[model samples]
Target: MKLYVIVSLWALVTITHQIKTQDNCVCEFISSEKPFPYDKLKMMQDSASNCNNLMSPQKAFGLESLLLGLNRRLPQLEDDVEMLEKEDDGELYGVLSLYVIENELTEIQAMIDKLNSSTSEHKRLGDDTAQKLEDVKEKMEELETFDAMQVMKKQQANQRLKRDLDQCRNGGLHPRPQPTKHTEGTCPHGRFLNVTGPRVFTTGEYPGSYKYGAWGRDPKPEEGKESWHWLVMLTSSNIYAHYVRFYSTLSSIIVGVSTPGNVLIHPSNPTTNTIQGPNVVLYGGALYYNCYNKDAVCRFNLTTKSITTLQLPKGTRYNSKANFCHLDECYVFTDLDLITDESGVWVVYTTNQDFGNLVLSKVEEEENQLLSLGQTWRTSFPKSSVTNTFMVCGVLYATRYVDKNLEEIFYSFDTTTGKENLNVGIFIDKMSPNILSLNYSPLDQMLYAYCDSKLVSYEVLFEKRSNFYL
Candidate 1:
């Protein structure tokens, strides 16, 4: 049997089916003689995109108008919970507040039920907030059975973890070096005054994939690589990394056009000497970082492929026991922060004996070229209160998160004078919400901040001074 069929759908597409053969009929549809117009199909796709881009100011697409203040009300409930949580004697007032919280929890549940958002982020936030609200309500109801002080302490810790998790879903330092007689040689500039610019900003090769990292110029870089920029991304579970990425120049990183060279800490990752946090810094020709899950620092020399370890005090915190935190988030496993300054490399950390206050130690290379900790100092500033810390001219500057767009340096600990100033008050205009790793490079006189997943640099503005009294 032989058959022929041709169908033309109006202003759309055409199809032809034909069968011609004796025994086993062969069918030939659209052929080279009359090919489908792929150009027209592409033009239709362009038109569809244009329609998608069309805009109309309409309230029907969102939930607030339908629910009469769903957006306004949800935030209020969250704020109320935070406000109550911050009160020193939270549980002392808990008995009276529990009823109100209970009412709020019920309302929150009702809101969650009423929400018809197809957005996964909205649904997840509602579900998670409802669960946490329920848990917090239970704790508030039971606060009567517990001691207020003990409950406060526990709540502080719980609040830290809660902020930590919510951030998982969402999301200083001092100076020091000894002074010399000549102002040009030592402490030439006055105290750190201000910071400006993203002087440089880039996502690099990995971009949004990496949320924790550090990037900067190695102050005393190896001969030819002096112009190179180094990046240490905490590539494993946000806890560790085994390689350092190298870019030839700053522009190369910003443009993200060049292939970066990688130097592996170990051929096998999570083995000995793997970097534990984003606080690692490259100084000279060596990379200094926290020893994996240990109260120690590891220096991996790039030229020699050799390593050196410096043990911290017995009570020193490691393995996420102490971390850099702000109201919004905590950078975990940051127990040991390696920093570099004009003098040399330094380690900023906290210890149990110090009650979680910042401890600074100088990392020195002895005559034998071995690294060791020297000149131990302690500061009254609590580590948990700060979002990050860095050093400039032997002065430790500490920053607390003011908001997503701002970080305020409200504290400075001068190692030489053993003086603490709570009014340093220098503010950084941030491009991202968090600065996980921060260090100052005397080589460039710039501050490098690994802000969330982005690498940003700031010019360290100093007060001009001709001479200084050592």
Candidate 2:
């Protein structure tokens, strides 16, 4: 029996020594190079722990060497991890993590299998051994949960990236449809020079059902008038308002010039009463207009004959005060606001006295208020004064007569800045002089001045030389 006991002791020692040597060999191999094989490193670590009795100083040195190798390759490992994240390789990461766990668990399983295969007469393991087994099992479960979570996160990130790319290609924010040429044509006189004036019939011996047409005739140009065209057909000379004119850029249209005759209005519920110029603006699928002397902003629904009116301020010239103020001559069409917001129509008008006092007021939802003085500015010159009432670059400009020589002066003012542009003038010798209107066209980036009852357009030609007004 003693001999048997001695023999068993010797076998155990030999087995322990052999395992130690094997672990050392593995560690030595791991420590040899960078990008240490993680799977192999993990196996060695597990082997060293699984059979601690086999460990020796040389094996310990080998284990330390493996740790050093891992440290050296740490930066590379980090790069791999980052790349993995960018690529959304959750499955790969999970697989690697699982491999490490499986290697450890497999070691435990091998030991368990060895214990099971041993003779029944052999000694049993202690409580500590059983506890270690249970711990390993718990670690495997945790790893499984971690793997699932990583997979879900990667999938979500991938979906978000796809959505962002799609938005970039589709113009996520301000998607605008491309504009196409409308061969069918717009208003016959070109895009109707949008006007805000009244419609009156021809008086005298002209017989017609609809005696007159709305003025501010922005008709498309005719084919032959490209060089110097003329649209002269005035059904009536009685222009109650100044909103009856528009100029065309395209020469392929024929806008009728004034015809020799009288003007009249179709009698209606309001007796088709005559008013001032039509205050017209095209916006939101409708033409907004108001009678020359009426105290209301009227909307003529082209889609439907439905006429809607919004009340103007009590002080507007559209009332009896307007006729009297006009020296009993009646107010004519003035100008319409180019910009339309939810607030209401912004109309600028001239007083009948011609002293050059311009009024700025808003036709709100249903009320009008003469804008305060601070909100308005006027331009004055030698013999004439004009209100800088028109808008360009969100700023308003007004012109005035500097001399009887027809030298004209203009000033630009910012409604928001309250700053004014320096006075500037254009000179053309021997030309009839009249400051009909000044306009800016955003489409062509040009500024126009109407003088001598004719139009002369100028290229603004330079950047705002100075925001001296800034």
The candidate that achieves the highest TM-score relative to the unseen native structure: 1
Q: For residues 1-470, could you state the per-residue lDDT of candidate 1 as single tens digits?
A: 22332233222343356566676765443432344455644555564454333321111222322243344456656776776777637566765566556765654554455445424545665566566556555654454344434767788889999777766664312232221211122365665567766566656567687799898989887787765888888878878899888866554455443434788779766778888888988988899999887899999988788889988889998889898898767889888888888888889999889999999999999898787789988988899988788878887777899987778778777777778887766677776788888999888788999987877777877667432210
197-294 per-residue lDDT for model 2 (tens digits): 01111111222221112322211213422222111122233233222222221111111122222222223212232333322443333345555345
Count backbone clashes in candidate 2: 44
Q: For each candidate, what TM-score against the reference?
A: 0.60, 0.34
Poorly placed runs, candidate 1 (over 4 Å) = 1-186, 258-260, 465-470
Per-residue lDDT of 73 in model 2 = 35
Local distance difference test values of all predictions, in order? 0.72, 0.35
lDDT of 2: 0.35
Model 2 alpha-carbon drift over 4 Å, by segment: 1-237, 241-249, 254-275, 278-290, 318-345, 350-357, 361-384, 403-409, 420-432, 446-470
